[model samples]
Every structure is written in C-alpha cells, then in structure tokens.
Target: MTDFSGAAFYGLVARLDELIATRPGGADGFSPSARVRTHQNGGYRSAFRGRGMEFDEVRAYQPGDDIRTIDWRVTARTGRTHTKLFQEERERPVLILLDARTFMRFGTRDTFKSVLAAKAAAVLTWVSMEGGDRVGGAVVMPSGIVSHRPQRSRGRILGFVKAMAEATQNGFGAPPPRLEPTLAEAIGRLRQGSRPGTLVFLVSDFHDFDAAAARELNRLSLQCQVTNVFVFDALEAATPRGGHYPVSDGEAISSLNADSAAVRAAYAQRFAARRDAVEALSRQRGMAFIPLQTGDDPAILLHPERMQRTRSGVRGAA
Candidate 1:
C-alpha cells in the first residue's frame, strides 16, 4: 500500500478551505448521460417544475405570444406591443450524504477515513459551485443526522465545509442521550428530504450498511442521482508485516499475532467481502461508484475520466 503518513494524515477547516481552488482532472459534466435538473440559471437546458421563471429580455410581441407575458408598461412607453421572454434555468442541487461515525475516524495509511471524507467533500462542494449547482449535504452524527438544504451561494458551501471539518476534527461530540442514528436511519431521512433531480454523494466505509440501508438507498435513487463513495484505508485491504502488534479498544489494549499466513489471508478475504457487498448494492453501472482510498488526492481522483482510468488500479491493489 502507498503510505504518506509523514506528510499528511489529518485536515482541518483551513485545509478544507484550501480545496476551493481544486480542479478535477476530467471533463465529467455532472451526470453526463442524464438530463440536468436544477434551480438557478447557468449551463445546460433546464426548466422549473411548473413554468420557466427566469426572464430574459423583452422584445416586440410576436404571433402566439403568451397573453400573460405581455409587457403593458413597455408597450405603453414604446407605443408598441411587447412581451417577456423567459429562459430555462440550469443548476442542479448536489447533496453529499456523509458518514461521520466513530469507525470512520480510524486509518493506518496516509489519513483517517473521516479526514479523507472531509477533503473529498470539500472538493465536491467547490466543484458544484463552479458548475453553478447549488450545494448542501447531510452528515450522520452520533446523535442523529444534520442536513443543509441546497443553496446557490458561496456562504452555504463554506458552512458545509465547516460542518465537515468539525465533524472530522471534533467528532459528533459525546453520544446522544438516546442512541446514534444508523446508516439506514440517515438514508431514510435523506430519502424523505431530497427533491427530484438532485445529485447525491453518499460517502462511507460501508460499516453496518444493512438491508434497511439498501432499501432506503434504492428508494432514494428513484428521485435523485445517487453516487456511492466507498472510503477505506490501506490496512483494511491487508494486514501489516507479520509481527506482534499492539491493538486498542479504547478501554483496553491487546497484542495481535500477525505471523500466521492464514490469519492474514482471512483478514484480506473479509475486506474483499465487505467491499463486494457494498459494490453490489451500488446498482452496477447505473449508479456511480467511487472508491476513495486513504492516500488518494480526491480533487483529481473524483473526475469521471480519471476515476474510470484509475478504478482498476484501485480495485486491483488488494
């Protein structure tokens, strides 16, 4: 595995803010194959649910012009019949569903999964802004889920960056009085909250991703474009060099015997099983699946073409 532990492992708000200058390595327009559905005016052809609300410029009234669009004041001023022209808006709502559970805080290579998720989330948030798409996300905390509605503004995106930074650095802060929300619960919340045509990025390590989570995800896919970002560390794919290593459970520490080849093999198989299980739930090629390892440069790696070229290398490693 490629390890960059000495150089980088954790990232804070400043680090996330720095990612605003990030540029992806591909020309992967958001959901290239699917039609664009958004709120604000920008690129691609799009219309509001009921009618086109963005007004262009006024011109002389033409034949078959909508009577409601007639500009009475402009017509009276110019002593001519005039009508309003409405253009379609093109801005998609991008929602990032993040898993900030305790397990995501662990990593053995370059950075923790939580840090990686934050970095990647920052990159995506900036990219969406650049594309003129509104940005927001839902974070799965120990207490429950925190969600931000999509908005076409820089402040909203930064707020999202801030939330992720705190989540990774400070964590969800002491467990709730009741219980933490499961991945399924978080997904269910998103399913109910998200609107049609929104693009969703679900980032997680697939820990405790159960049938309930899959069902919720399937339902969510019907309305929004869902992409599964599978985050993992190098150690998860393989055991380290054979030796007696110290392990911890927060409450106590223990030593692990890694000398046995069978044990190492079993560990690798378990990782593969978990990965395959999540991949299966990703709905094949119909849904986007991104594999983000701990050592990856998320800004460049997230591009569709770059991801396509590197996918084999990522999956082939372990």
Candidate 2:
C-alpha cells in the first residue's frame, strides 16, 4: 500500500509514483473528446494548418523548393545551393500548465486543490505518453515557475514530477504576483517552448482568472489545442450546513458562520457564479473544460464512461 501519510495537503511526493504506476492501465479510460487531436500521425487531425516538420535531408535545390529552407553552410562549402527536405513529424507535444499558488492550497474535502491538480496533470501526462506524444509541463507556484520542455523521454517526465513536488512543498510563503501578469508569463513560456500542434492543459482553481487571462488563453488556443481543467473543492460549491468554519491562508485565519441561512445561500451563489463564468469563457474560446472536485477519485472522474455520462446528463438538464 502507498503511504500517503507523509504528503502535505498539496505535496506531490507520495501521490506521483502511484499515479505513474497506474499508467499501465492506459489513459484510454478518459473521454475521447478530452483527448487532444494533434497534427501528428496517430490520432485525430486538427482543422488548423501548419503541422511541424522534421528535417529529412539536404538535397540539391529543387526549382519549386522554398528558398527559406536553403542550407547556407552546405551551399558555401560545396558551391552548390542545397534545400532542406522535411517531413511532417509523427508525434505532437503535450504541455501541462499547473497552478500551485496560495489559493489552490486550501481544501476542506479529501485533498487540497493543488494536489488534485497534480493528480490530474499526472494522469494526463501519462496518457499523453501512452499515445506516443512528447510530454512536458510548467508548475506555477507562488515561489516561481518551474517548467520542462516537452520530450518523449521517461526521464523528462520524472523530472517534471519532481519539480511539482518541490514546488508544492515550498508552499506559499509570500503573496504571489498578480494573476494576470503571472498568467502572461506562464503563457509566454508556453509559447516559447511549444509548437503549433501542441496540446496544452491549463490546470488551476482559476481564482485569478480575468479578462487578461482570458485573452492569453484565446491567444494560446489559436496556436494549440487548449484544455482548461478546473479543479475545485466540493466545499467551495456547498459549505457544510449549520456550522462555523475556520479558514487560513498561511498568513491569517478567518471564520465563516455557515449557520446563517443567508450566508450559506450567498456563499453557494458566489461559487455558482464563478463556475458559470469559467464555462462561459470556455465556450467563447472553443476550449474544452473539465471540472474536477477534490473529494472525487481522480481515476473515476477521468473515466471515459463517467465523463460521457456526466456530460450527457448535463446536456439533458439544459
């Protein structure tokens, strides 16, 4: 049995290994709709053009060859202009952007929002790897951003998991920078590291999401397949009835009087509004959205059958 007792609420050490071990079951269990389509060979094709090309060889310049691909060094050495030939790459890259900020550390359910985000990311990473895609990610922490360039190697994935563990253990010692700027920076890093056909996952509680973040997301979606994995605690949507609850953000503590009917109603309303706003933004941008609750089992939540059923039920309600 895995020893989960050593895990801090948001830490990744105890859980990551177990999550990786579960990869043998394969990621096919997740909804196929949630599986990202890349320009690469294996899966679905994207509507967008300009798939990444891998250099094949240098040959004598062909009349119809694009001049941009000319091998200047070869031309200079042999006094013959040569053009580079490239074929479409066989695999696409998957980038997971995780939020480990102060707000994500709080949870009243089975685990912290940060931990859930990590689990979700881990599962996604393993799935991507199973699909023969390169996997990489960035962990956005209050301390700083920890990122890994996408690669197919198992070592890279292990490194990414280690980085997430370190970031979570550091905790939120200082107030993080404003959400918009931090998101901008993270997006910039993604833009720098990823290619056009990359599948990007943005995992967070979205406490800091706003117009600026939305703009960044839109920009990213234009270049890549973007998915927003919104992780939240069950208590956020519905507080426990008739009890006073204490909450702390490391620096200070506050008590919530959930006994009052009016307060409970207002609290639930706030959470509902936030969820609606996120869903609206996802629809506007044509991005996929998956909501994961802290109390839920990650494996069950990600199960394809369960996801399809939940979505069907939601559509029927509407």
Candidate 3:
C-alpha cells in the first residue's frame, strides 16, 4: 500500500494496482504477435495482422464470390463450388494462470516470488488493456482456485487482483489445504474451458510440475497462444553463498549447508533440469519463456529482448 511493492515478501491490493503505471512504453509493449494460428495451412504462416481474420467455414459459392477463395477440392468432390469465408477475430482475451502454492511465498531477496508474479501479472493486464484487450485470470492455490472469467469491467479486474492477493498467502485464513483438484486438475479445467485465440500467460515457480501438467499445456498451446513465466528467487536459481541457511516447509524446519561443492553442483543440476523442461516446452510451442527472479524489474518482465541485454542467462531458474 505504501510503495509499488508492499512488503519485501507480500503483496497488497493497492500495491498491485499501482503496477498499471509501470507498463513499458516501448513499441511492442508486450502485445502478443498479431498472427493467429489455425488448422488451415498446417497451423503455420499467417497473413493477417492486428486482430487478424480466422477461417469461418466453407459454404456454397455465390455468384459474386471471389474465385480466389473457392475451395477446388470441395468443388471437385461435390460438383458444386465452395468458397472460404472468414470472420475477423473480434475479442481475444489475455488470461493469466498464477501459482500460489506455499513455496511461492518464500524468497531471499527484493520480493517474494508470489509478489513478483502478482506484479508481473498486473503489468501484463495493463499492457493488454492498453491494446484494447479483455483481461482476466485464475489463481491456483493449495486450498482451492480463485478464478475470474475474462472481461473488461473494472469491478471484475479488481476481483481478479483480490484473488491473486489472497493467493500469495495461499487462501483465506480459515480453509485447510486440500487436493480436491491439484495443479494438474486446475490446468485441465482451464484447458477444457479456454476459448481458441485466447492469449495465456502462465506465471509459476513450477516446483511441482509433472507429466500431467505438461500434457495439459501441450494441448492448450495448440489452441491458445501461450507465454510461460518461470518465477524464482535467488536461492532457488542458485545455491546460497556457501553458508548454513535455515529453511522450512511449514511442518518441519531444516537447515541447508551449501559449504560442499558437490551439494551445490547437484542443486544446480536439478534446477537446471527443471528450468530446461519449461524452456523446452516453450520452444516446442513457439512461445516466449521468461525467467523472472525476485529482484528483477517487474516492468521488464515481459520484454525478453530488453531483459536479455541486461540479464545474463541463468543455468537454473525456478
């Protein structure tokens, strides 16, 4: 509530709202590529720009129909000419899927991973809004999910922010954690309901990511445009500076010794494998993979080109 960030490790409603002012002023401004992928043309090489046009259906060719749009195969099969008709994509909403598991609340630097994710999501929302797009999101938590349907209403936007703020701390104070639906199930729900042409930004540490989640993402990318934001704290990305550090998983307390080089190497390799899996998925889907650390500037989170100039590649991020 006081600054653009509330506390170093927590997020607040007012603080997240302040991120609207932090949107990048560059030409791109985090707007998704205007190209829309479709089954036609083998799902590649789009010609239209901005909102773009999508193939609607082939129909009986009329007298005034352009010969260029005629489907020759259909004409030969039915002995009647068919014409391809297209509809302009009118509304493509920006959807963000955020992970609010307990681990996201832990950080050793500028802000908590959860707070960083919230801020990044806020920036993305405003950026999309500036381009005249609808914005909405869902927060996946251990207790349950807090979801807001896509819309442009101010009230709905506020509700989305509220859900994320609560998510940073898991959920409302009273609910006990449950597995009614795990992260995989939550993603599956989104996969089933998300409309084609939706631009999805998934923000998560992805510590518990599994094959089921990957399957959902693979299917989801086939329809909607996806951008994966892999959020992490310094400690998670790298071994802490060769010292004894205390850590806990809510139920038990433990101390981590980073004095051994072998331990550090193993930790690095494990994080690297996790990070590579996410990055590979992004590459496979032809989408953006952004590795955001706790101390990185939230405004630059979406601009990988700019982020690259200033940030070095991390062997591990997550």
Candidate 4:
C-alpha cells in the first residue's frame, strides 16, 4: 500500500493507455498475450429480447415472414414496405479476483506485493471500462470484506480504485489486525459468484492454500477466461543475510533463522521450492500466469517489451 496518492493513480492511468495502445494482438513474437478462446463461448445474457432486428435487420418478404409480422399488409396501406427493427447483445463482463492476503506484505524493494496487486487491478479495471466492458472485482483480504459489483462506466472503475487504495492502506498497517479472511475460501466464493465466460483475473501470491484451494482455481479456469497474476516479493526470492529476521502478521511475531551454512542453504532451497510449486500449478492448469515483482515496473509488466525498441531485444524475449 504505497502512499497511492492522486499523482501515482494518474501516472498509472497514463501508463495503462500506453500499454494498451502498443500491445500487439494475436500469436506473434513479443506481443502482450491476451488470452484467446477458440473452443468456448461464454458471456452474459440480455434482460429482454426486444422486438425487431436490433443488430442485423432483414427486409420484409412479400409473403413470407409469418403473415402476423407482415407490415400490416403494407399493400393495403401506401404500397411502401418495411418492418420494425431491434438490436443484438454484445456486452461482456470482466470479473477480477484480487488476493490481498497477509503474505502479500513481504517485500524488499520500492513497494509491497499488495501495492503491486492493487496497481494491476487498477490498470485492468480502467482498461476494461474504457473498452465499454463491465468491470468488477473483490479485494480478498482479511476475508472478503470488500467487493464491487460489475459495472459499465468510468465512475465505477474510479470507485473500485478508491476502495482498493483504502484497503491497501488498511492492510499495510497490520496483516489482519481485526477479523481477516483466508485466500482459499475467498477465491471459491468469487468463483461461485462469477458467471460463465467472464474474463476473470485471479491476482495473488497463491501461498500455502493447500490442494483444495488449487482445485477451486482449476474449476474457475474451466468455466471462465481465467488469468492468473502471481504477485511476488523480492525478499521471497532470497534473503539478505544468513541470519534470522523477526516477522509478524500484526497478530503474532516469529523468527525465521538459520545458524550453520548448511542450514541456511537448506532454508533458501525450501523457500525457492515453495515458489516453484506455485508456478507449477499455473503451468499445469494452462492459465496465463504473469509474475509481478515488487521492484519491477508496472508498465513493463503490462506491456512487456514495448519499452524495448531494438530488434535483437524483441528477438530475445523473457
């Protein structure tokens, strides 16, 4: 929860525009991959089926269109012929499931993992809103206290950004000082609420939720266009020293330390293994997993190699 004041928000908004504009489409070399589903068709439904051809209009047949719909026998009238029209449905909903859990607080760079998560959510929300799509999401931390309904306006995105900013602020003070929520259950609830075909973004650290949690994500991915953003802290990748450090989640404090060189190496190995497990799950599920680090630039994460202008640079993609 970096002090996300007005300036930071505005900067993020500007960067988002640049990212969306320059991102390449379809399967290519260094394009920012937007997931494409060729085998599935999923989306929302219209409340009413309006009369007349709303999208594709058809000309009235001389004596074909089931007589009842005939233009009141236009021949009896002025001899001119026509039919009333209607429109088709084209709106889709984008649901974002952000995991603002306690583990996200770890960082050794410019900001915490939680701050990066919020920024990503803001960027996605703004992009979807600008694209004339409904945007909504849940800030699943301390257990799911904050969630916004899917909406189709810039104002709604702003409201979501504001709420996320505040939640980040509150979360920074303590992991879950009051009654907080768990990530595993929160994701399950989000899956249940989402409709089929919703472009769902499940943003989180994906830390220590167990097999049940992994299964829930697998289920959600099968039904919707699921995108997983794995938020990570530079600290989690490595420890600064070979000693211990006192860590707390606002509720209790504990020490993680290693005495001998062998023990320290073992500790580091175990830490890396856990991170690898998270990546493995994403790969197994075939979900687009984007790893976001604390020190990394958000613009780079969204646009990938747009910052690089050289042919060789693009040739060597990360």
Candidate 5:
C-alpha cells in the first residue's frame, strides 16, 4: 500500500506543468479513438462536428449549387453564375468545470482524484486550443469558484491551468459548500459565460451527486453539449480482499471491515447503484458520461479506440 502522508495528499500542484504538457494525437489535436456524442434529432452524432457554418468565399456556380446560395449581386457584377460557399466554423469554446472539493483529494492508486481531474482538464484545454477552439473553465472549490471566460488565447488556457494548480495547493480553507448548491453555482457561472453551442466538461468524483444536482446539469445540457467525466478510485468499484482497512478524512479516522463476504457485496452494490444513477441521469438528459478510475491513465479517456475496445470486451464477456 502507498503512504497517504502530508505531501502525498496535496501534491497535485507540482504536477501542473506536466499535466499541461499532455498533447492528444491528431491534426486537430483530438484523440482519434475518442468521440464526443451530441444529441441531435433524438439521436447521437459526433460532438465535434465543427457544426457552425461561416461564409468562406464566392465561386462560379457548380451543377449541384443550391439556388438559395446563388450570390445574385456577385453574379450581376461578374456577369457569371456565382455561388456562396460556407465552411464549417471551428471556433467553438470548450468550458471545463472542475470539481476540487475536499472529497476529490483522495486516491488509493496512482494519484488523488483531484489531480486526475486537473490532468484531464489540462489535456482538454490543450486539445481545444490546438483545435482552434476557445478554451476556458471554472475550478469549483469548497470555498468559492475560480472561473475564466472562454478565449482563444494560449495564455488564457494556461492561466486556467495555473488557477487549478493554485486551488489544489491552497485547499478550500473554509468549510465546503453543500454539493448541490456548489453545482448549481458552477452551472450558473457556465450559463453566463458560455454560448449555446459550447462544449462543457464536468470533471469530478461527483461524491454528493443527487436529483437536484442532476436537474441543474440537465438545464445546462439543454443549451450546450455537456460531458460528465466521473473520476473515481478502483476501490470505489470493489472492496479489497477480506481485510480490516482504516480510512481517514484528516479530522476523522474510521476502520472499514471488508472481511465479511456480505459486507463486501453490499459495498460493491452500493457503488454500482450510485454509478448507475449517474449514468441514467446522463442518458436521460442527453449528456455523455465518461468514467475514469484513479488507477488508470487519464489519457485513456481521450483515446476513443481504446475505450471502444474495452467496451467491446465487456459486452462480449456479458
């Protein structure tokens, strides 16, 4: 077992630079395997379609030209049949809402959930910026929220990353706000800062996810493309081999008895139920759900092919 000492718990700050350096592969800087799904016509499609359209240029009319786009003025001036061409607009902004509550500062594997969330957000920021999209996000801490309006500047994206690192190091200071209220506040900020077509990523362990919180997220999803990146530890999905384990939350220490088969089964069932509820809520509200375990590399979420293969294996086994 790894030590959960002072330095280990809040060491995410030192890793911020490394996290920001992660670059997903592709000309668009998006992972080839990963695809964000968007809800359109009650069906799912690739989320990053570059859907927005912008007029590119006017050219001589072609056989299949839509009559509606026949630039009458240009045709008259040039004495030729001319058509207006539009290209896919790719300036969509990506807003990443990172949950940095105290609950997220734990991990039994590679690193704390907070660190993983920060790393994921950093990867997203880099990918979005490299893809020519505006990148910004809010870091939701227990004490308050640190938000950066979406912008196309590289400095802005790096600033957001720096803010996350600072928040991780300083801790929330005051008592943490209630989960639902915090989510609501974060969502409100997102609503104010983001446009309708923006992509929003909610990265967190979602420790106190509830009906009201889900409702808030649903409201956000109605306006923008939302993806829930749920960060959790492997221990959350399964209990360790029969043993008495001790846990601490800084202020309080408790022992968990995983010796009994029934206890372990019940623990696993509870976690599964919570996970199911989150997944169901995401599906109900047309949001994409990505689950990241603490032990796994955060980059895996960006890799679509790897995720597809994992899903295929799971379905085959079932």
Candidate 6:
C-alpha cells in the first residue's frame, strides 16, 4: 500500500495557495474572490473569517460619550450613565466529515474515490489551518462509528491526515477488518460532533446511502456552511468500448463478451439517471454540491465555472 503521508502530504499543502489564488474574487457573487476576507485572528491572510461580535461588557462612559452612549434613558430612570462594548468575533473551527466507506474504495482513473476525498479534505484542512481558523473533523469508519471529535489546531489536522492514511492502507489495501460506513451514518456522526454554525466539508463518494441522508444534511446546513464533495471514477462513469471483463468472487474469472450497443446504451442511461437523481436530491436540499471527476484536474473542479454552478444550484434549490 502506498503511504500518502510525510513530505508528500505536506507537498499537497503548497497547492492550496494556488487553489486560493484560482478561487473567484469579489465582495459579491459566487466568485472565490468574493469569499476572501481577512483572517479573524487579525492576520492579512485568508478569505473567510469570523464576522460575529464578541461581547466585551458594559463600561461607564467618560467624556467622549458621543451622545450615542449617553444612556439618557438610563440616566432618566437610574440617574447613572453606562455603555455597552464588544469585541470582534474570531474565526471558528471548521469541521470536515470524511466518509471512508467501502463504496468510496473503488476508482478507475486517477485514484480511489477515498484517496481523492482524503486529498480534498487535506486541502481544506490546510486552507483553514493556515488561514488562522481552527480545524478538526470526524472520521466515519465502517459500522457507523466515529473515530474522533471535532477538533481545532494544526497539529490535530495533521494527526487526522495520518490516521486517515493508515486506515486507507489497512482497510482498503490488503485488509484486516474490511468494513465501510454508509453516507447516512457518516452524516449522523458529523451532526453529533459538529458545533452549530461551524463551516463543514462533508467529503465522500456518496454511494450506497439513502435519501434520508440528504434530509439530515439539509437540517445540518441550517446551522453550518455545508459543502459536499462528490467523488467518482471516470471508468465507473463512462464504460469503455472493449471486450468483456471477467468477474469473480470466491470464483474463477471467466471471459464474457462485452454487451451489445443497446445494452450499453441502457446501462449508460441508468447511470445518467442515477447521477441526476443524486444531484437533484442534493440541490433540493439547498446544498453546495461539488462533483469531482478523478480523470480531471483537481484545479478544474475548483474553478470558477464549477464553483458558480454550486452557488446557482444552491440558489435555485432555495
């Protein structure tokens, strides 16, 4: 099993700056630039920062009350003057729910869906962590179990990446306890651990899950900024024009001729319907859906066109 860790993983962080650069810029619209803001911790970096006010406390007004804080009403009642003050809200933690299910274990073009999902998670982690926002997430393993709580800190994010790599190698490569969680299960885990109003990235192939998951996601979105990263393999999506491929499961691999044009067309139609249904369900829930094709460049998936598509989908759904 290839260990996607150490320097190699750190190398991926470098790509984040480029990703941020490619993001649409502006104070409005779905452009990534529009999303840019100062780091909440008072840095000149990052594009998304906290905007809420932190309560400082009431203080007695001195000379320069500006009449706004004169507390005339209070003086009329209590014969004393007081004023309210508050601090700027700092950036909150960003939670990433990584669904490493059996269905995500398959991919045919670039890498396994799980791999791509993890990479995307890593990228987001770096962006958030370096942006001065805390980062943490829950890893949904098979049996619908959660591995950790929603955490904060760069160290915690790195530990998560390491753990995810290990799990992929152990469970997907050659195996011990081969198990995978369903999409609904993963969402449930996330809901349990996430704080309200947290920015969340739910990364998965979104396979073998019921529509109930979509409903739960909608509910979660009411509290958090939810983004869905839908991962898939090119081969699984578009069937190639080739001879029959053998299949086996505790059985011998037998060569069978490829299906006829009509059969292939039927299969393609079925797949198209399935994709449309999934996309539609997500859209109906007013979710930001990012469809990631393994064969395409990751940068392209994060491009303006795709990002705008997500924004429009969410708006239309709303």
Instruction: Tell me which residue pairs clash in candidate 4.
Output: 52-85, 52-86, 53-86, 54-86, 54-87, 55-87, 142-180, 142-181, 143-181
**Candidate 3 lDDT by residue in tens digits, 130-186:** 555567877777677766777777667767776766566554233445453466776
Tell me, by lDDT, which candidate is best: 1
Estimate the TM-score of every prediction. 0.72, 0.72, 0.75, 0.65, 0.73, 0.66
Give candidate 2's error at residue 2 in angstroms: 19
The top-ranked prediction according to TM-score is 3
> Candidate 6's residue-wise lDDT over 1-318, tens digit each?
354444554322222233234323221111132333433432221222322244344566677654564556656667678765544443445788876655666666656666666666666665665555666777765444455554555566667666555444444334324455566666777777676556678877676546777667777777666777776665555456757877543246765344567655665665556556667766776556677765545544345264443321122111
186: Cα error in model 4, Å = 1.6
Question: 202-286, model 2: which lDDT tens digit per residue?
Answer: 8888886667776777788777777787787767877777788887755689999989989988888887777677777778877
Give the TM-score comparing model 5 with the true structure, all chains together.
0.73
> For residues 1-318, could you state the per-residue lDDT of candidate 5 as single tens digits?
323234545544425565666656662544222342222111122343322254557889889778988899999999999988764433356899988778887777777788788888877877777666667878887667878988777777778888776666544344445542366677777777877767788888777777767777877888787878878877777788878998776667898888988888888888777777778888888777888777666777665345443421111000
lDDT of each: 0.70, 0.67, 0.69, 0.59, 0.69, 0.56
Mark the 10 consecutive residues where model 3 has the least summed lDDT.
Answer: 41-50
Q: Candidate 2 regions off by >4 Å?
A: 1-16, 28-44, 49-90, 172-181, 301-305, 308-318
Per-model clash counts, in order, read: 1, 0, 0, 9, 3, 8
For model 1, residues 16-78, the per-residue Cα lDDT tens digits are 444454545442345444355323344544333223655666899889888899989999999
Of 2 and 4, which scores higher on TM-score? 2
Model 1 clash tally, residue pairs: 1
Which model, 4 or 6, shows the larger lDDT? 4
Give the RMSD in angstroms, all C-alphas superposed, for model 6.
Answer: 9.5
Ranking by TM-score: 3, 5, 1, 2, 6, 4
Spell out the clash pairs found in candidate 5: 33-304, 33-305, 34-304
The collision pairs in model 2 are none
The TM-score, computed over Cα atoms with residue i paired to residue i, of candidate 1 is 0.72
Report the candidate with higher TM-score, 1 versus 3: 3
